[model samples]
Target: MKITKLETVIPRDIMPGLLALRIHTDAGHIGHGETYYVPEAVASTIHDWMAKRLLGANPLEIESHWRFLYERTTNFGSRGCELRAISAIDLALWDILGQVCDQPVWQLLGGRSQDKIPVYNSSAGPSYAGKSNEPHDSHVWPGHGCVGHEGPLNDYWSVVNRPTEYVQELLDEGYRAVKMWTLDFAAHKHGGPLYLSKQDLEVGLRPMRAIRDAFGNQIEIMLDGHGFFQLPTAVRIAKAMREIDPLWLEDVIRPDCVDTIADFRRQTDVPLAVSEMMIGMEDYRLVLEKRAADYIMIDPTWVGGISQTHRICNMAQSYNVPVVMHDCTGPLTLLSGLQVGTATTNVAWQETVRSQIRMIYPKLISGTIQVEAGYAHASDEPGIGGRWLPELFEGSTYQHRVSEAGR
Candidate 1:
């Protein structure tokens, strides 16, 4: 079947900067795909540039399309908006392929290697990264508004305000692992992540200590530094985190320098999980070569898509490193990760925000991601199973763009 048209829908109201792509083919099939962050730019890349290559081409040529878009983009740049657009297109192509073959994407990618994928909750409220009315530049500080919204599903606030209670609640709900960024508040207070004073160090470590005191390693704790801290400060945070014995220190320092991360890893015994921030396989290859991270974190939508994620998983397997799926963004990202993670044997745990799953996902997608206890169940439905709701584009506030073949 030949691709006939490409369409992009931006539901900025639901999730700011979330872009969803729809690929239409002559075979009477439409496939849906999505990526998080910067919807406008991603949409432009697809409609203006990538659409010419895809239109009238075979819809099943997933690998060829990925390579073409990636190789061509690399001539200028590969990361950020260009790669994100390619990721969305690749996912749409895979979705089409899955439907054409009458199988799920995971089955197309060699079936299930594991029975169920374990999931870890990252502390975020429903509105943590959601489109906000407040006009504040979030990047200026490490974690400026770390604690947002005080409610039952506001795990971010609950984790910082009542650490032991939050831990008990998560344990009662059957979550064995949890990740949070309490240090970012202090990192912001000390003028970015360059410096961490003795007092602020104590301040940041308090909640974590509280959890350790109450739960005593019953649940694995992960500290996400958000790539904010410098190497020395990251080392100090890692040294302090040793008392709590976290599952891993994730992106404590920026992922730009694998050598520096390797240096930080050498200084601390705390297992390092370096980074969803590092995009593409080249960055990951350096991390593996340097022995920088014990565990590697990858965001399927951020890296490329299912094709790239599967490839990276195999690459990580060669290094004997476990892959952790990252999704602090949109529902499609979570579902895409689930599809690849289910088929890959070396995958450890899928990152989730229960708040987002509960509050935001239902509004955007047609199907739900099954999470019973703490494990995510794989879906056998053809294609990605869940897709962006038709009503999303029907609204007046949403932005929709289309590029049709022969137009």
Candidate 2:
């Protein structure tokens, strides 16, 4: 069918807002796509840039439209925000294709490789407003059984009531792995570089050690440094945590600095996971070619859509590196990532926030994808099998409205 209109919607939330794009066809079917960019800009890019380029185009020409948008933005910059905008449109095209053909996105990619993909609990902490230092309470935290929330007491505990308590809760919930951001609070407390002092290293490693000692390797622990360190400090921290044996050290350095990531990989024996900020297959190609990391972390929202993510996985497969989909935002991201992972052969494990599942999943059209024993199965339903709940969108600070012309 011919394309009629394009629209972008940003749903407000404490976490990064949802950058959703809706592509309406002349036949009256609307397809949805989302990007993981800052909320304010997501809507603007769709309305001001992508919508103008995509109008009157064929909805089923997914690849042509992707390249057209990419070529049109080449003078600006092929990566980053340009790719993010293209990603929203690309996902929308895929959504339209799936809906029109009466098949799921995964099925269109190539039939399902596996029924379920293993998922690790992501964003395993407290809600945005909770007290960070509130005394650890087992009853309050949801995923206490996995690994205690480890970060600044206030931010960490606020999202994950009691650190250790939530770890225990995760274990009870049958989650085999959990991930949390580590350096933000430690960096804040030190008031300088992260690895500047022995005290800083100890402070940084304490929460992880506590969890390791408590769980005794029963659970897989992953640490996200959030690209907060330089090469030297990242190496030092990775060395210190080598004994604790994290599943992977995430974004130790920025994704753009391939050389630094390669250096960090060389200095530490622990597996390095990088590229959570990557936007396309070429970005992933550079990391894989350099052997910059042992594991590649891709977020579907930032990394073009399910289509591009699948291509990146294939590229990573050539390097013999495992892929771990990185999703720290809302339910749409998690579900989209899972769809790619299901069809991927070299996937490490998917990430999810054990606590937010209840809050986010109910808004989906097909409810939520089920995760049992740390694994999730993709739905066979048409499209992504999830629809946004407009009621849930009401009064949310994360939602941004686009002009009707954009749609």
Candidate 3:
């Protein structure tokens, strides 16, 4: 069928957040996709810019449509907002294609490598304050197995006062892997910059070391440097944490400098994880081609949806590099990433923020994502298996300032 309409909806949220696109065809089927960006205003900017080209194109020609959008926006640059827009449209097209063919998106990509892909708790443990409490508050837990089946507790609780207690809690919950932000964002105030200082590095690795010592190698620990350091400092910190033996060091340096990433990779023995901020195939290509990272990370919302993610994963597989899908956003993002993970053979693991799980699970339309023994299983359902619930957006507010043409 031919394309007839393209619609965008930006769900109002705490930060400039998730933008959803609905692509309608003459045959009356609509596909769904989402693009994640910031300044909150970029959503509307991208929506309007892409609308001009997408209005009457053939929705099924996913590759051609992707290229047209990419070339048309070359002058605007391809890294951030433009790529994010492309991602949303590309994803919606995949959704439409799946609906038309009567198959799950994963099957369309290629059959599943495994029925369920193993998932890691990307953001479990303590909160930013370093509190010992569970990653989520009381309101967030909707009860175990509410979505489909009972899964392990994958929460990202922050403990401000008791760091040791936090580690104990996760181990007690039967969680084998957990990720925590070591350097304090607020701690940057004490130093001239936000990066870890010599003292900061000592302080930061203490908790990680303690957790490792307490739990031993049986537990896989991950650290989020949060792009808080320059390349040199990042290398130093990664080297320092080598003793801790982290599963991966995440987004340690800014994504802008490919050369710097290469430099960091050369200096550190730790497996570097990059690309939480990347938006499309070009960004993924740069990271892969440069050999800049041991593990490539892509958020489906930010990185041109399921179709592009599949392409990127295939490329990574050729390089013998594994991919870890990033999921620090809402539920739609989690489900979207799940579709890609199931179809990908080289995916290392999928990231999940237990703190946001409670807020996101209710939005699912069908099937269930059951987590067992630290792995996630996708439902045998069509589409992404999720729906946009009006109640989730009840108190949410969004501001859209699209150019007349973009609108």
Which scores better on TM-score, 1 or 2?
Answer: 1
What lDDT does each candidate get?
A: 0.87, 0.69, 0.66
Off by over 4 Å in 3: 13-16, 39-42, 124-174, 190-195, 361-368, 390-407
In candidate 2, residue 36 scores what lDDT? 62
Clashing pairs in 1: none
* Local error of candidate 1 at residue 342 (angstroms): 1.1
Worst 10 residues of 2 by lDDT: 138-147
Task: Report the C-alpha lDDT of model 2 over 90-126, residue by residue, as the tens digit.
Answer: 7677778888999988888887877788888764444
Which 10-residue window in model 3 sums to the lowest lDDT? Answer: 141-150
lDDT of 1 by residue, 90-165 (tens): 8898899989999989999999898889999998887766765544456543124457657758888888899898
Question: Candidate 2: what lDDT?
Answer: 0.69
Q: Model 2 Cα displacement at 225 (Å)?
A: 0.3
Quick one: ranking by lDDT, best first? Answer: 1, 2, 3
Backbone clash pairs in model 1 (N, Cα, C under 3 Å; residues 3+ apart or in different chains), count: 0
Count clashing residue pairs per candidate. Answer: 0, 38, 17
